[model samples]
Every structure is written in structure tokens, then in C-alpha cells.
Target chain A: QQQVKQSPQSLIVQKGGIPIINCAYENTAFDYFPWYQQFPGKGPALLIAIRPDVSEKKEGRFTISFNKSAKQFSLHIMDSQPGDSATYFCAARSGTGNQFYFGTGTSLTVIP
Target chain B: NAGVTQTPKFRILKIGQSMTLQCTQDMNHNYMYWYRQDPGMGLKLIYYSVGAGITDKGEVPNGYNVSRSTTEDFPLRLELAAPSQTSVYFCASSYGNSYEQYFGPGTRLTVT
Candidate 1:
């Protein structure tokens, strides 16, 4: 079963526009939510993460908005750039904080 | 520091063949992980180790084996290659269970 479900398998946006990717989970035991970004032929790198204790977290142009009651989280890239084009993954950590469940992936493209 | 490094950037295996994917980290992390990423599918954990001499299976550990002999090395072994096993393998490490993970570029393997 898919523990984390992500929407909009692919996305296209203009430069400077905000591109958002959403993900939802059913397991309340998950406490840590992280976003990873992967460029072609490269490994997925940690983008930003949010714990259930907080409703939002931001780093640079990336922001993660989380809703604990809904068990949903989203990534918003402000001023999206072509260089930001890549595959994004949202993941949730098990209660033990050792194992993680990842969403399928979202390919985002920023057209200049 | 070379956070994480994986050997054999690309490889092709024939049915019934066997091979080992090498991984090394210079971060001296206590936690290491092996994951497989298929097209559009997010990363799936194959195996992980909390520390040297301690290892455990993850979501999809079948058809794969792993060992963490040193804090720097975590190798993944595949016996009897199958088409379904074709995917990009990634190695990651973190200081602790709650710390952010650093991922290697990845190893693209094709099993025919």
C-alpha cells in the first residue's frame, strides 16, 4: 500500500511563479515529514523538512506547509526557476524515526 | 567531505547473474541506508544499518542483501538478477536517526 500519496505527477510553471506539490498520509504515527529534490542522473537531496510540532517551515525559496489534523503537507517553491526543475519526493518517518515512507514523485518544470 | 559515494555508476546484469554494489561514506555517520528508485516511483528502502555490525531489512529487502562491516561502508548484494530488479540504487547516511540524510549520486542497473 502507498503510505504517502502525492498529487500532480507532473507540473509546469513559468519563471518566478510559485509551484506547489502536495502529499498526504494516513499514518498518524509518522512524525517527521521531509521533502527531497532529485536532478537527472543525481541522487535525491534533502530540501526541507517539518515536524508535526510546527505547521510550517521555510528555507530559502522552499517552504513546507503541514496540516497535522489533515495528515497532509505541501511544498511551495517561491520564484521558481528553471534550475529548480527536478523530481520532488515527500516522505514521512515512522514513529520510531528509523524508517521512512516516500511518495511516488512529482516532476516540476519551470519555463523561462 | 565526500558525504556518500556509490560505485558502478551504471551496470548491466544478465539473468541468473550476481553482483555487489559498493557504498562508502566519509561523514562517519552511524546510520546508513540502501534504496532503489524506479521511474516515477520514489525511493524504496532495501536495507539499513544503525551502526556497524547491526543491520536490518526494510520495505523491499527480497532479492537483495546488505552488510555494514565498517561505519564507512555499506554494500548491497544482489543474487540471481531479474528484470524486475532493474532500477537506480542509492546509498545514504546520516549522523543519527533524526538527522538529515546525505545521498550518493546513484547506481543505474539494468537486469535483462
Candidate 2:
């Protein structure tokens, strides 16, 4: 079962614009949602994360908007830059489980 | 702090060959995971370990084995290389499995 689903397999945005990537999960037990950024030939790294308790969380130029009732969440990149061009993955983990579910991924390209 | 490190950044193997991908973390995390990523696909977990000597399978665990002999070392073994196994492998560690998962660079494997 695809526990987590992500939209927009690829995206393109202009520099200084905001680009958003969304994801949804089916498992209700999941409480932790995290976003990862990956560059070519590199492993994905944690970008930002949020729990089900909060509606939104922002760090620097990145923000995560989450809705517990809808089982959906999104990652927004503010003032997108060329350096932000890469693949982004959304993942969810249950509070008590050792497993984590990951979304397919979204490739973002920021135009200079 | 050399959060996580993987050896043999890239490798090419022939069918039926066997090799082990080594992963080590300096963070002394208790949770470790091995995941594989295919083109345009989200990462699939192969194996995971909660602590030394405790291992479990993940979503796609076929033809792969793992051992957590120590908190710092988690090695993934491939008994017989196959074309289907050609993908990028990543190692990740988490302190207590909450939100953050630190990842190693990655190992690119090609089987012919």
C-alpha cells in the first residue's frame, strides 16, 4: 500500500518565487512529517519537519503547512533560488513504529 | 562530527557477485536504516536496526541482509548482485526515532 503520496512529479519556479510541494498520507497513526532535499548523486537530507499538533512551522526560507484532519501536508520554499533546485521527498512516521513511509518525490528546478 | 559515513561511494558488480555496503555513524544513534532509491521512485527500506544485534526487514528486503554489530556500524550485504538491485543506497541514523534522521552521502551501485 502506498501510505504516502506526493504530487507534481516535477516543478519549475522562477528565482525569488515561492514553490510548493504537497503530500498526503493514509495512515492515521503517523504523527511526524518530514521533508527531505536531495541533490544529484547524494543522499536525501532532512530539510524541515512538523508534528500533527501544529498547523504550520517555518524555518528560514522553508515552511511546512500541515493539516491533521485532512491527512495532508506541504513544503513551501520562499524566494526559491538556483541552489534550491533538487529533488524533494515527503515522509511520515508513526509515533510508535520503527518504519517510515516516503512519497514518490518531486524534482524542483529554479530558473535563474 | 561526521554524522554518517558510507564507504565505496560508487561500485560496479557483475551478476552473482557478492559484496557488503558499510555504514557507520558518529552520532551513536540507536536507530539505523538501509534504503535504496530507484530513478523517479521514493526510497524503499531494505532493512533496519533498532540497536546492536536487533534487525528487521522493511518494505523491500529481498536479497539483502543486514547486521548491526555495534551502534556505530550497520552493514548491508548483497549475496547475489542482480540488475534489479542497481540503485543508489543510503544509510540513515536517528537518535530515538522521532523527527530527524541523519543520512550518509550514499553509495551508487550498478549490477551488470
Candidate 3:
């Protein structure tokens, strides 16, 4: 079973537009959610992360909105630029274990 | 701090070949993980180590073995490589309390 499912396998948006990617998980024990951005030929880097205790978090142009009751979460990029084009992955991990489950990944493109 | 680093930026091996991917972290993080990324697919966990002597298999660990003999080094070994093992491998490290994971540049491996 896929523990975390992400939507919109790919997306394209004009500069300054908001693009959103979403994910959902089935495991209730998951307490931490994180988003990663990866450029071609490069490894993924952490963009932002949120704990289930918070409803939302923002860092620069990246924001993560989480819904614990719905077992869902979404990532929003505000005022996106071409530099924001990359693959995005949403991941969840249980607080008790060191293992993390990752989504398939969303390829995002921002055109100027 | 060099955060995390991986060796052999790229490699190509024939079927039944064996190789080892090396990973090291300058940061004294308590948790380390190895992942493989394929095109259109997200990152798949291969193995993880919580400490120098504690290691466990993740979602996809077949044909792969790992050893964490020191806090700074974690190496992944492929016993008998196959075409199905062709993918980019990444190493990540994080603190026990911190949810953020730092990733290495990645090693692209192709098994022919």
C-alpha cells in the first residue's frame, strides 16, 4: 500500500501565480510532514516541514497546510518564479520511528 | 560542515556486478537514510540507520545492504546489480529531534 499519495503528477504556472501540490496519508501514527524540492540531477532538499500540531506553516514563498483530521496536506508556492521549477515530494514519518514514507513527487514548472 | 556527501557521482555496471556507494556526514546527526530515485517516481527508502550500530531496512531494500560502523559514515552495498537497480541514489542525515533532513548531491548508477 502506498502510505502517502500525491496528486497532480505535473503542473505548470506563470510567474507570480500560486501553484499547489497535495498529499494524503493513511497512517494515523504519522506526526511529521515535510516537503522536499529537487532539481534535475540533484538530490532532494528539505523546503519546509510541519508537525500535526500546527495547521499551517510558511517559510519564504513556501507554505504547508496540514489537516490532521482529514489525513491530508498541501503545499502552496506563492509568487512562484521559474527558479521554483522542480520536483516536489511530500513525506510523512511517525514520531516513534525513524522511518519516513514519501510520495511519488510532483513536477512543477513556472514560466515567465 | 559539508553536511552530507556521497562518492562516485555516476557509475555504470554490468549485470551481476557489485559495487558500494559511500555516504558521509560531517554533522553529528543521529539519523541517516539512503534512498533511490527513479524518473517520474519519487524517492524510495532503501535503508536507514539510527546510530552507528543500529540499522534497519526501509520500504525497498532488496539487492542492497548497508553498514553504519561510524557516526559519520554509512555505506550501501549492492551484491548483484541488475537493470532494475538502475537509479540515482541519495544519502540524507538528520538530528533525532529535528525533522529536517539534509541530502547529498546523489550518485547516478546504471546497471546494464
How does residue B45 of candidate 2 score in lDDT? Answer: 85
The CA-based lDDT of model 2 is what?
0.92
| RMSD in angstroms between candidate 2 and the native structure over all alpha carbons | 1.1
lDDT of 3 by residue, B53-101 (tens): 9999998999999999999999999998999999999999998846788
Model 2 spans > 4 angstroms off:
none
| Candidate 1 vs candidate 3, TM-score winner | 1
User: Tens-digit lDDT track for model 1 on B1-112?
Assistant: 8789999999999999999999999988999999999877789989999999999999999999998889999999999999999999999998889648899999999999
lDDT per residue (tens digit) for residues A22-79 in model 1: 9999999998999999999999889999998899999999999999999899999999
- Model 3, stretches more than 4 Å misplaced? none
Q: In order, what lDDT does every prediction score?
A: 0.93, 0.92, 0.92
Over A24-61, each residue of candidate 2 has an lDDT whose tens digit, in order, gives 98888897899999998778999998988999999999
Best by TM-score: 1
Candidates sorted by DockQ, descending order?
Answer: 1, 3, 2
What ranking emerges by TM-score with the best candidate at the front?
A: 1, 3, 2
Give the CA lDDT, 0 to 100, for residue A38 in model 3.
90
Model 3 interface CAPRI class:
medium
lDDT of 3 by residue, A35-96 (tens): 99999887888999999899999999999999889989999999999999999999998766
Global local distance difference test of model 1: 0.93
TM-score, candidate number 1: 0.98
